[model samples]
Target: MLAEADNGAELAASMAELKAYLRIESDGEDAVLAGLLRSAAALCEQFVGQWLIRRGARETVPADGRWHRLAARPVVAIGAVAAVDDAGAVTPLPVEAYAIDIDASGDGWVRAVRPGNRLAVEYQAGMATDLNGVAEPLRQGIMRLAAEHFVARGDEGAAPPAVVSALWRPWRRMRLS
Candidate 1:
Protein backbone atom coordinates (compact mmCIF):
# COMPACT_ATOMS: atom_id res chain seq x y z
CA MET A 1 0.00 0.00 0.00
CA LEU A 2 1.40 3.35 -1.00
CA ALA A 3 0.06 6.76 -1.95
CA GLU A 4 1.33 10.26 -2.67
CA ALA A 5 0.15 13.72 -1.80
CA ASP A 6 1.75 16.99 -0.72
CA ASN A 7 0.28 16.42 2.72
CA GLY A 8 0.76 13.27 4.82
CA ALA A 9 -2.87 12.97 5.92
CA GLU A 10 -4.23 12.43 2.47
CA LEU A 11 -1.54 9.94 1.63
CA ALA A 12 -2.30 7.96 4.75
CA ALA A 13 -5.99 7.67 4.03
CA SER A 14 -5.20 6.51 0.54
CA MET A 15 -2.80 3.85 1.82
CA ALA A 16 -5.51 2.34 3.97
CA GLU A 17 -7.75 1.98 0.96
CA LEU A 18 -4.86 0.49 -0.97
CA LYS A 19 -4.17 -2.24 1.56
CA ALA A 20 -7.77 -3.29 1.77
CA TYR A 21 -8.21 -3.24 -1.98
CA LEU A 22 -5.35 -5.54 -2.98
CA ARG A 23 -6.68 -8.78 -1.56
CA ILE A 24 -6.67 -11.76 -3.94
CA GLU A 25 -9.44 -14.36 -4.29
CA SER A 26 -8.53 -18.05 -3.88
CA ASP A 27 -8.43 -18.52 -7.61
CA GLY A 28 -6.63 -15.21 -7.99
CA GLU A 29 -3.92 -16.67 -5.77
CA ASP A 30 -2.68 -18.73 -8.65
CA ALA A 31 -1.07 -17.07 -11.71
CA VAL A 32 -3.76 -14.48 -12.30
CA LEU A 33 -1.51 -11.58 -11.42
CA ALA A 34 1.90 -12.79 -12.53
CA GLY A 35 2.38 -10.83 -15.72
CA LEU A 36 1.30 -7.59 -14.15
CA LEU A 37 3.79 -8.18 -11.36
CA ARG A 38 6.52 -8.79 -13.90
CA SER A 39 5.64 -5.59 -15.71
CA ALA A 40 5.65 -3.70 -12.43
CA ALA A 41 9.11 -5.06 -11.71
CA ALA A 42 10.26 -4.07 -15.16
CA LEU A 43 8.90 -0.59 -14.70
CA CYS A 44 10.76 -0.28 -11.44
CA GLU A 45 13.96 -1.69 -12.92
CA GLN A 46 13.75 0.51 -15.97
CA PHE A 47 13.41 3.77 -14.06
CA VAL A 48 16.06 3.51 -11.40
CA GLY A 49 18.03 6.51 -10.14
CA GLN A 50 15.64 8.84 -11.87
CA TRP A 51 12.81 7.74 -9.61
CA LEU A 52 15.18 7.35 -6.61
CA ILE A 53 14.34 4.79 -3.87
CA ARG A 54 11.56 2.33 -3.11
CA ARG A 55 8.30 3.78 -1.84
CA GLY A 56 7.40 4.19 1.84
CA ALA A 57 4.04 4.23 3.53
CA ARG A 58 3.02 7.03 5.82
CA GLU A 59 4.75 6.58 9.16
CA THR A 60 1.51 7.38 10.93
CA VAL A 61 -0.07 4.33 9.36
CA PRO A 62 0.47 0.89 10.96
CA ALA A 63 1.36 -0.96 7.75
CA ASP A 64 4.22 -0.66 5.31
CA GLY A 65 2.79 0.82 2.11
CA ARG A 66 5.66 0.52 -0.31
CA TRP A 67 5.15 -0.31 -3.96
CA HIS A 68 6.79 -3.67 -3.29
CA ARG A 69 3.69 -4.69 -1.36
CA LEU A 70 2.07 -5.58 -4.66
CA ALA A 71 4.64 -8.31 -5.06
CA ALA A 72 4.42 -9.24 -1.41
CA ARG A 73 1.23 -11.27 -1.63
CA PRO A 74 2.31 -12.78 -4.91
CA VAL A 75 5.49 -14.23 -3.35
CA VAL A 76 7.75 -12.45 -5.77
CA ALA A 77 11.35 -13.06 -4.70
CA ILE A 78 12.31 -9.66 -6.02
CA GLY A 79 10.36 -6.56 -5.03
CA ALA A 80 10.81 -2.79 -4.75
CA VAL A 81 10.95 0.22 -7.05
CA ALA A 82 12.78 3.60 -7.12
CA ALA A 83 13.50 6.27 -9.68
CA VAL A 84 16.82 8.10 -9.60
CA ASP A 85 17.84 11.35 -11.21
CA ASP A 86 20.76 11.96 -13.52
CA ALA A 87 22.87 13.15 -10.59
CA GLY A 88 22.58 9.69 -8.99
CA ALA A 89 20.55 10.78 -6.01
CA VAL A 90 18.03 8.62 -4.12
CA THR A 91 14.69 9.81 -2.78
CA PRO A 92 11.48 8.07 -1.84
CA LEU A 93 9.73 6.69 -4.91
CA PRO A 94 6.06 7.29 -5.68
CA VAL A 95 3.49 4.50 -5.51
CA GLU A 96 2.19 2.87 -8.65
CA ALA A 97 -1.05 4.64 -9.48
CA TYR A 98 -1.88 2.55 -12.52
CA ALA A 99 -0.47 0.54 -15.42
CA ILE A 100 -1.44 -1.50 -18.45
CA ASP A 101 -1.31 -5.28 -18.08
CA ILE A 102 -1.87 -7.49 -21.08
CA ASP A 103 -2.04 -11.21 -21.69
CA ALA A 104 0.86 -12.47 -23.78
CA SER A 105 -1.53 -14.57 -25.84
CA GLY A 106 -3.53 -11.40 -26.53
CA ASP A 107 -6.55 -12.71 -24.78
CA GLY A 108 -7.17 -9.46 -22.91
CA TRP A 109 -5.78 -6.63 -20.82
CA VAL A 110 -6.57 -4.73 -17.68
CA ARG A 111 -5.69 -1.35 -16.21
CA ALA A 112 -4.63 -1.29 -12.61
CA VAL A 113 -3.86 1.49 -10.18
CA ARG A 114 -2.28 1.17 -6.79
CA PRO A 115 -1.98 3.68 -4.00
CA GLY A 116 0.86 6.03 -4.94
CA ASN A 117 2.86 7.39 -7.82
CA ARG A 118 5.39 5.24 -9.65
CA LEU A 119 9.02 6.36 -9.88
CA ALA A 120 9.35 8.68 -12.87
CA VAL A 121 12.92 9.20 -14.15
CA GLU A 122 14.49 12.23 -15.71
CA TYR A 123 17.26 11.97 -18.35
CA GLN A 124 18.38 13.46 -21.62
CA ALA A 125 20.43 12.46 -24.67
CA GLY A 126 21.80 13.88 -27.90
CA MET A 127 19.76 14.00 -31.11
CA ALA A 128 21.44 10.82 -32.30
CA THR A 129 20.70 9.00 -29.07
CA ASP A 130 17.34 7.73 -30.29
CA LEU A 131 16.44 6.18 -26.93
CA ASN A 132 13.20 4.83 -28.37
CA GLY A 133 15.26 2.70 -30.72
CA VAL A 134 17.06 0.89 -27.88
CA ALA A 135 17.05 -2.91 -28.05
CA GLU A 136 14.66 -4.98 -25.93
CA PRO A 137 17.44 -6.52 -23.84
CA LEU A 138 18.72 -3.08 -22.87
CA ARG A 139 15.17 -2.07 -22.03
CA GLN A 140 14.80 -5.12 -19.81
CA GLY A 141 18.11 -4.29 -18.16
CA ILE A 142 16.82 -0.85 -17.35
CA MET A 143 13.66 -2.35 -15.92
CA ARG A 144 15.77 -4.77 -13.91
CA LEU A 145 17.60 -1.95 -12.17
CA ALA A 146 14.43 -0.02 -11.52
CA ALA A 147 13.03 -3.07 -9.66
CA GLU A 148 15.98 -4.88 -8.05
CA HIS A 149 18.99 -2.58 -7.63
CA PHE A 150 18.40 -1.19 -4.14
CA VAL A 151 18.22 -4.57 -2.40
CA ALA A 152 21.05 -6.23 -4.35
CA ARG A 153 23.52 -3.81 -5.94
CA GLY A 154 22.69 -0.11 -5.75
CA ASP A 155 22.21 0.92 -2.12
CA GLU A 156 23.61 -2.17 -0.43
CA GLY A 157 26.96 -1.23 -2.00
CA ALA A 158 27.70 -4.31 -4.05
CA ALA A 159 31.21 -4.51 -5.57
CA PRO A 160 29.92 -2.83 -8.67
CA PRO A 161 26.75 -0.81 -8.28
CA ALA A 162 24.31 -2.67 -10.51
CA VAL A 163 23.23 -1.36 -13.88
CA VAL A 164 20.16 0.89 -13.65
CA SER A 165 17.97 2.60 -16.20
CA ALA A 166 18.73 6.29 -15.86
CA LEU A 167 16.69 8.78 -17.86
CA TRP A 168 15.23 12.27 -17.70
CA ARG A 169 11.48 12.93 -17.85
CA PRO A 170 11.65 16.11 -19.81
CA TRP A 171 8.26 16.08 -21.51
CA ARG A 172 6.38 14.39 -18.69
CA ARG A 173 6.02 16.64 -15.68
CA MET A 174 4.62 15.53 -12.37
CA ARG A 175 0.86 15.97 -12.38
CA LEU A 176 1.04 17.07 -8.77
CA SER A 177 -2.06 19.00 -7.98
Candidate 2:
Protein backbone atom coordinates (compact mmCIF):
# COMPACT_ATOMS: atom_id res chain seq x y z
CA MET A 1 0.00 0.00 0.00
CA LEU A 2 1.04 3.56 -0.63
CA ALA A 3 2.16 5.38 2.45
CA GLU A 4 -0.79 7.57 3.28
CA ALA A 5 1.43 10.48 4.26
CA ASP A 6 3.45 10.38 1.05
CA ASN A 7 0.50 10.05 -1.29
CA GLY A 8 -1.41 12.62 0.68
CA ALA A 9 1.47 15.06 0.44
CA GLU A 10 1.79 14.47 -3.30
CA LEU A 11 -1.93 15.09 -3.70
CA ALA A 12 -1.81 18.26 -1.67
CA ALA A 13 1.24 19.58 -3.44
CA SER A 14 -0.12 18.86 -6.92
CA MET A 15 -3.41 20.57 -6.10
CA ALA A 16 -1.64 23.61 -4.73
CA GLU A 17 0.65 23.84 -7.76
CA LEU A 18 -2.26 23.53 -10.18
CA LYS A 19 -4.22 26.23 -8.40
CA ALA A 20 -1.21 28.50 -8.57
CA TYR A 21 -0.67 27.76 -12.25
CA LEU A 22 -4.25 28.51 -13.22
CA ARG A 23 -4.25 31.70 -11.22
CA ILE A 24 -1.31 32.77 -13.33
CA GLU A 25 -2.26 31.06 -16.60
CA SER A 26 -6.00 31.76 -16.85
CA ASP A 27 -6.70 34.69 -19.14
CA GLY A 28 -9.50 36.74 -17.59
CA GLU A 29 -11.35 33.58 -16.61
CA ASP A 30 -12.36 33.02 -13.03
CA ALA A 31 -8.97 32.13 -11.69
CA VAL A 32 -10.44 30.51 -8.63
CA LEU A 33 -12.60 28.12 -10.66
CA ALA A 34 -10.00 27.44 -13.32
CA GLY A 35 -7.61 26.71 -10.53
CA LEU A 36 -10.06 24.20 -9.17
CA LEU A 37 -10.21 22.27 -12.45
CA ARG A 38 -6.46 22.35 -12.75
CA SER A 39 -6.18 21.08 -9.24
CA ALA A 40 -8.57 18.25 -9.99
CA ALA A 41 -6.63 17.17 -13.07
CA ALA A 42 -3.35 17.29 -11.25
CA LEU A 43 -4.77 15.28 -8.41
CA CYS A 44 -5.96 12.61 -10.80
CA GLU A 45 -2.48 12.24 -12.24
CA GLN A 46 -1.11 11.85 -8.76
CA PHE A 47 -3.75 9.28 -8.02
CA VAL A 48 -2.85 7.20 -11.09
CA GLY A 49 0.83 7.15 -10.29
CA GLN A 50 0.39 6.54 -6.61
CA TRP A 51 -2.09 3.77 -7.24
CA LEU A 52 0.26 1.99 -9.64
CA ILE A 53 3.09 2.29 -7.18
CA ARG A 54 0.89 1.04 -4.40
CA ARG A 55 0.10 -1.98 -6.53
CA GLY A 56 3.80 -2.97 -6.52
CA ALA A 57 4.88 -1.91 -9.97
CA ARG A 58 8.58 -2.69 -10.25
CA GLU A 59 9.12 -0.26 -13.08
CA THR A 60 7.31 1.94 -15.58
CA VAL A 61 9.83 1.17 -18.32
CA PRO A 62 9.27 1.94 -22.00
CA ALA A 63 7.67 -0.91 -23.91
CA ASP A 64 6.27 -1.32 -20.47
CA GLY A 65 6.54 2.49 -20.07
CA ARG A 66 5.35 4.93 -17.46
CA TRP A 67 3.41 8.19 -17.27
CA HIS A 68 4.99 10.88 -15.21
CA ARG A 69 5.26 14.60 -14.72
CA LEU A 70 8.77 15.74 -15.50
CA ALA A 71 7.45 19.25 -14.98
CA ALA A 72 4.32 21.39 -14.79
CA ARG A 73 0.56 20.75 -14.79
CA PRO A 74 -0.49 17.31 -13.55
CA VAL A 75 2.31 16.47 -11.19
CA VAL A 76 2.32 12.68 -11.01
CA ALA A 77 5.94 11.66 -11.19
CA ILE A 78 6.44 7.94 -11.82
CA GLY A 79 9.35 5.74 -12.93
CA ALA A 80 12.98 6.53 -13.53
CA VAL A 81 15.69 7.42 -16.11
CA ALA A 82 16.22 3.72 -16.79
CA ALA A 83 13.24 3.85 -19.13
CA VAL A 84 15.38 5.95 -21.47
CA ASP A 85 17.01 3.99 -24.27
CA ASP A 86 20.68 4.64 -25.00
CA ALA A 87 20.33 3.18 -28.53
CA GLY A 88 18.54 0.38 -30.44
CA ALA A 89 20.05 -1.89 -27.80
CA VAL A 90 16.93 -0.79 -26.00
CA THR A 91 13.99 1.30 -27.13
CA PRO A 92 12.82 3.63 -24.44
CA LEU A 93 9.19 4.35 -24.11
CA PRO A 94 8.81 8.07 -24.47
CA VAL A 95 7.38 8.96 -21.11
CA GLU A 96 3.61 9.09 -21.10
CA ALA A 97 2.04 12.14 -19.55
CA TYR A 98 -1.33 13.52 -18.49
CA ALA A 99 -3.44 16.50 -19.43
CA ILE A 100 -6.88 17.61 -18.36
CA ASP A 101 -9.02 19.83 -20.53
CA ILE A 102 -11.95 21.42 -18.76
CA ASP A 103 -14.61 23.24 -20.68
CA ALA A 104 -15.81 26.66 -19.55
CA SER A 105 -18.32 24.58 -17.64
CA GLY A 106 -17.01 22.62 -14.68
CA ASP A 107 -16.90 19.22 -16.40
CA GLY A 108 -13.46 17.59 -16.41
CA TRP A 109 -11.84 16.02 -19.46
CA VAL A 110 -8.44 14.40 -19.96
CA ARG A 111 -5.73 13.66 -22.55
CA ALA A 112 -2.07 12.72 -22.83
CA VAL A 113 0.21 15.75 -22.90
CA ARG A 114 3.64 14.16 -22.98
CA PRO A 115 6.24 16.65 -24.12
CA GLY A 116 8.95 16.39 -26.74
CA ASN A 117 10.87 18.54 -29.21
CA ARG A 118 11.02 16.04 -32.10
CA LEU A 119 7.98 16.40 -34.32
CA ALA A 120 8.02 12.72 -35.22
CA VAL A 121 7.88 11.39 -31.70
CA GLU A 122 4.56 10.58 -30.10
CA TYR A 123 3.38 8.74 -27.03
CA GLN A 124 0.95 6.38 -28.67
CA ALA A 125 -1.36 4.29 -26.57
CA GLY A 126 -4.98 3.19 -26.31
CA MET A 127 -6.00 6.62 -25.00
CA ALA A 128 -9.69 6.30 -25.84
CA THR A 129 -9.96 2.95 -24.12
CA ASP A 130 -7.90 4.17 -21.20
CA LEU A 131 -10.10 7.21 -20.91
CA ASN A 132 -13.26 5.17 -21.06
CA GLY A 133 -11.97 2.78 -18.45
CA VAL A 134 -10.69 5.44 -16.11
CA ALA A 135 -13.40 8.07 -16.48
CA GLU A 136 -15.81 6.96 -13.79
CA PRO A 137 -13.13 5.76 -11.42
CA LEU A 138 -11.13 8.95 -11.81
CA ARG A 139 -14.22 11.01 -11.15
CA GLN A 140 -14.68 9.16 -7.92
CA GLY A 141 -11.01 9.54 -7.09
CA ILE A 142 -11.17 13.26 -7.76
CA MET A 143 -14.21 13.52 -5.58
CA ARG A 144 -12.38 11.72 -2.82
CA LEU A 145 -9.35 13.99 -3.13
CA ALA A 146 -11.54 17.07 -3.36
CA ALA A 147 -13.42 16.00 -0.30
CA GLU A 148 -10.15 15.67 1.54
CA HIS A 149 -8.94 19.07 0.40
CA PHE A 150 -12.28 20.75 1.07
CA VAL A 151 -12.51 19.37 4.53
CA ALA A 152 -9.00 20.49 5.32
CA ARG A 153 -9.68 23.94 3.88
CA GLY A 154 -13.20 24.25 5.24
CA ASP A 155 -14.67 24.51 1.73
CA GLU A 156 -18.09 23.21 0.69
CA GLY A 157 -19.60 20.79 -1.80
CA ALA A 158 -17.90 17.78 -3.36
CA ALA A 159 -18.06 17.64 -7.18
CA PRO A 160 -20.63 15.19 -8.51
CA PRO A 161 -20.46 13.00 -11.64
CA ALA A 162 -23.56 14.61 -13.10
CA VAL A 163 -22.09 18.09 -12.82
CA VAL A 164 -18.66 16.94 -13.91
CA SER A 165 -20.02 14.99 -16.85
CA ALA A 166 -22.10 17.92 -18.01
CA LEU A 167 -19.18 20.30 -17.86
CA TRP A 168 -16.86 17.71 -19.37
CA ARG A 169 -19.09 16.90 -22.35
CA PRO A 170 -17.65 19.69 -24.47
CA TRP A 171 -14.04 18.99 -23.71
CA ARG A 172 -14.60 15.27 -24.07
CA ARG A 173 -15.42 15.89 -27.71
CA MET A 174 -12.45 18.17 -28.27
CA ARG A 175 -9.81 17.05 -30.77
CA LEU A 176 -6.11 17.63 -30.48
CA SER A 177 -3.95 18.98 -33.29
Candidate 3:
Protein backbone atom coordinates (compact mmCIF):
# COMPACT_ATOMS: atom_id res chain seq x y z
CA MET A 1 0.00 0.00 0.00
CA LEU A 2 1.10 3.55 -0.65
CA ALA A 3 -0.23 6.98 0.24
CA GLU A 4 0.96 10.55 -0.15
CA ALA A 5 0.67 13.13 2.56
CA ASP A 6 -1.32 16.32 2.04
CA ASN A 7 0.59 18.84 -0.07
CA GLY A 8 -2.23 20.85 -1.62
CA ALA A 9 -1.00 24.23 -0.48
CA GLU A 10 2.52 23.50 -1.56
CA LEU A 11 1.29 22.22 -4.95
CA ALA A 12 -0.76 25.39 -5.40
CA ALA A 13 2.29 27.46 -4.58
CA SER A 14 4.30 25.55 -7.16
CA MET A 15 1.66 26.07 -9.81
CA ALA A 16 1.72 29.75 -8.99
CA GLU A 17 5.48 29.73 -9.37
CA LEU A 18 5.19 28.00 -12.73
CA LYS A 19 2.70 30.60 -13.86
CA ALA A 20 5.04 33.35 -12.83
CA TYR A 21 7.92 31.66 -14.65
CA LEU A 22 5.81 31.56 -17.80
CA ARG A 23 4.85 35.21 -17.31
CA ILE A 24 1.21 34.20 -17.19
CA GLU A 25 -0.63 36.87 -15.23
CA SER A 26 -4.14 35.49 -15.55
CA ASP A 27 -5.95 32.40 -14.28
CA GLY A 28 -7.20 31.69 -17.80
CA GLU A 29 -4.83 28.79 -18.21
CA ASP A 30 -4.60 27.67 -14.60
CA ALA A 31 -6.24 24.29 -15.21
CA VAL A 32 -4.05 23.45 -18.19
CA LEU A 33 -0.96 24.65 -16.34
CA ALA A 34 -1.83 22.53 -13.32
CA GLY A 35 -2.16 19.43 -15.49
CA LEU A 36 1.13 20.18 -17.21
CA LEU A 37 2.88 20.64 -13.88
CA ARG A 38 1.58 17.32 -12.59
CA SER A 39 2.73 15.58 -15.76
CA ALA A 40 6.14 17.17 -15.45
CA ALA A 41 6.47 16.14 -11.83
CA ALA A 42 5.49 12.58 -12.68
CA LEU A 43 8.01 12.41 -15.48
CA CYS A 44 10.71 13.80 -13.24
CA GLU A 45 9.96 11.23 -10.53
CA GLN A 46 9.99 8.43 -13.11
CA PHE A 47 13.37 9.58 -14.41
CA VAL A 48 14.83 9.78 -10.91
CA GLY A 49 13.21 6.49 -9.81
CA GLN A 50 12.22 7.96 -6.46
CA TRP A 51 9.31 9.78 -4.97
CA LEU A 52 10.08 13.50 -5.03
CA ILE A 53 7.20 14.19 -2.64
CA ARG A 54 6.97 12.59 0.78
CA ARG A 55 4.68 9.53 1.05
CA GLY A 56 3.88 6.49 3.13
CA ALA A 57 4.69 3.08 1.69
CA ARG A 58 4.21 -0.50 2.78
CA GLU A 59 6.30 -3.24 1.28
CA THR A 60 5.85 -6.93 1.99
CA VAL A 61 8.69 -9.37 1.65
CA PRO A 62 9.59 -12.87 2.76
CA ALA A 63 11.16 -13.09 6.19
CA ASP A 64 13.67 -15.79 5.29
CA GLY A 65 16.51 -14.76 7.54
CA ARG A 66 17.99 -12.56 4.84
CA TRP A 67 18.11 -8.84 4.16
CA HIS A 68 15.36 -7.50 1.92
CA ARG A 69 15.58 -4.15 0.21
CA LEU A 70 12.75 -1.67 0.47
CA ALA A 71 11.39 -0.24 -2.79
CA ALA A 72 11.38 3.38 -1.72
CA ARG A 73 14.56 5.44 -1.45
CA PRO A 74 15.66 8.14 0.96
CA VAL A 75 13.44 6.65 3.62
CA VAL A 76 12.56 9.35 6.12
CA ALA A 77 11.40 6.91 8.81
CA ILE A 78 10.16 3.41 9.46
CA GLY A 79 6.77 3.52 11.06
CA ALA A 80 6.25 -0.16 11.78
CA VAL A 81 7.19 -3.73 10.97
CA ALA A 82 4.80 -6.62 11.25
CA ALA A 83 4.53 -10.29 10.45
CA VAL A 84 1.65 -11.65 8.45
CA ASP A 85 0.27 -15.17 8.52
CA ASP A 86 -1.41 -17.13 5.76
CA ALA A 87 -4.74 -16.29 7.34
CA GLY A 88 -4.02 -12.59 6.93
CA ALA A 89 -3.44 -11.92 10.60
CA VAL A 90 -0.83 -9.28 11.32
CA THR A 91 1.37 -9.27 14.41
CA PRO A 92 3.38 -6.17 15.13
CA LEU A 93 7.07 -6.66 15.74
CA PRO A 94 9.18 -4.66 18.12
CA VAL A 95 11.97 -2.46 16.90
CA GLU A 96 14.52 -4.76 18.43
CA ALA A 97 13.15 -7.75 16.54
CA TYR A 98 14.51 -6.43 13.27
CA ALA A 99 17.34 -4.38 11.87
CA ILE A 100 17.00 -1.44 9.48
CA ASP A 101 19.78 -0.02 7.36
CA ILE A 102 20.06 2.87 4.90
CA ASP A 103 23.09 3.05 2.70
CA ALA A 104 24.79 6.30 1.68
CA SER A 105 22.91 6.33 -1.63
CA GLY A 106 19.56 6.18 0.22
CA ASP A 107 18.67 2.55 -0.41
CA GLY A 108 16.96 0.92 2.59
CA TRP A 109 16.92 -2.63 3.88
CA VAL A 110 15.37 -4.64 6.71
CA ARG A 111 16.06 -8.03 8.17
CA ALA A 112 14.16 -9.88 10.83
CA VAL A 113 15.97 -11.44 13.76
CA ARG A 114 13.78 -14.50 13.52
CA PRO A 115 12.55 -15.70 10.18
CA GLY A 116 8.81 -15.74 9.47
CA ASN A 117 6.56 -16.32 6.49
CA ARG A 118 6.34 -12.68 5.50
CA LEU A 119 6.77 -9.21 6.91
CA ALA A 120 5.25 -5.83 6.19
CA VAL A 121 7.44 -2.77 6.46
CA GLU A 122 5.82 0.64 6.57
CA TYR A 123 7.88 3.74 5.93
CA GLN A 124 7.97 7.30 4.67
CA ALA A 125 10.23 8.03 1.72
CA GLY A 126 11.12 10.95 -0.56
CA MET A 127 13.60 13.75 -1.11
CA ALA A 128 11.26 16.37 0.28
CA THR A 129 8.07 16.65 2.29
CA ASP A 130 6.81 19.44 0.03
CA LEU A 131 7.56 21.15 -3.26
CA ASN A 132 9.39 24.04 -1.59
CA GLY A 133 11.69 21.59 0.13
CA VAL A 134 12.70 19.84 -3.10
CA ALA A 135 16.20 20.48 -4.46
CA GLU A 136 16.39 23.66 -6.52
CA PRO A 137 17.54 21.88 -9.66
CA LEU A 138 14.66 19.45 -9.50
CA ARG A 139 12.17 22.20 -8.83
CA GLN A 140 13.49 24.24 -11.72
CA GLY A 141 13.45 21.19 -13.94
CA ILE A 142 9.78 20.62 -13.19
CA MET A 143 8.92 24.21 -14.07
CA ARG A 144 10.98 24.19 -17.23
CA LEU A 145 9.53 20.91 -18.36
CA ALA A 146 6.03 22.15 -17.64
CA ALA A 147 6.70 25.32 -19.55
CA GLU A 148 7.96 23.25 -22.44
CA HIS A 149 4.83 21.17 -22.34
CA PHE A 150 2.73 24.31 -22.21
CA VAL A 151 4.44 25.65 -25.28
CA ALA A 152 4.12 22.38 -27.14
CA ARG A 153 0.58 21.63 -26.03
CA GLY A 154 -0.75 20.91 -29.49
CA ASP A 155 2.35 19.14 -30.74
CA GLU A 156 1.37 15.66 -29.58
CA GLY A 157 4.44 13.80 -30.80
CA ALA A 158 7.13 16.08 -29.45
CA ALA A 159 9.43 14.57 -26.83
CA PRO A 160 10.49 16.43 -23.73
CA PRO A 161 13.52 18.64 -24.30
CA ALA A 162 16.94 17.36 -23.22
CA VAL A 163 17.39 20.00 -20.52
CA VAL A 164 14.95 18.25 -18.15
CA SER A 165 16.96 15.08 -18.21
CA ALA A 166 20.20 17.03 -17.84
CA LEU A 167 18.86 18.65 -14.71
CA TRP A 168 17.63 15.38 -13.23
CA ARG A 169 20.34 12.95 -14.29
CA PRO A 170 22.58 13.59 -11.29
CA TRP A 171 19.85 12.39 -8.96
CA ARG A 172 18.84 9.28 -10.93
CA ARG A 173 19.12 6.05 -8.98
CA MET A 174 20.78 3.13 -10.71
CA ARG A 175 19.78 -0.46 -10.09
CA LEU A 176 22.19 -3.32 -10.57
CA SER A 177 20.66 -6.24 -12.32
Best by TM-score: 3
lDDT of 3 at 149: 90
User: What does candidate 1's lDDT look like per residue over 1-177, in tens digits?
Assistant: 323222222122222222234443344432323332334333532332112122322211112224221211111122233433446454544445323222232111112244422333221111112223333444344334323432352345443224432332221122223
Per-residue lDDT of model 3, residues 42-126, tens digit only = 8888899888888888888888889988887788787789988888789999888888888877778888889888888888888
| Ranking according to TM-score, highest score first | 3, 2, 1
lDDT of 2 at 77: 25
Better of 1 and 3 by TM-score: 3
Worst 10 residues of 2 by lDDT: 118-127
TM-score of each: 0.18, 0.26, 0.91
Quantify how close model 1 is to the true structure by its C-alpha RMSD in Å. 20.5
Candidate 2 lDDT tens digits, 28-76: 5344343454466554554333221121122222222223212111223
* Residue-pair clashes, model 1: 29
The TM-score, computed over Cα atoms with residue i paired to residue i, of candidate 1 is: 0.18
Number of clashing residue pairs in every model? 29, 5, 0
Candidate 2 vs 3: which has more TM-score: 3
Cα displacement (angstroms), candidate 2, residue 156, comes to 17
lDDT of each: 0.29, 0.34, 0.84
Top-scoring candidate (lDDT): 3
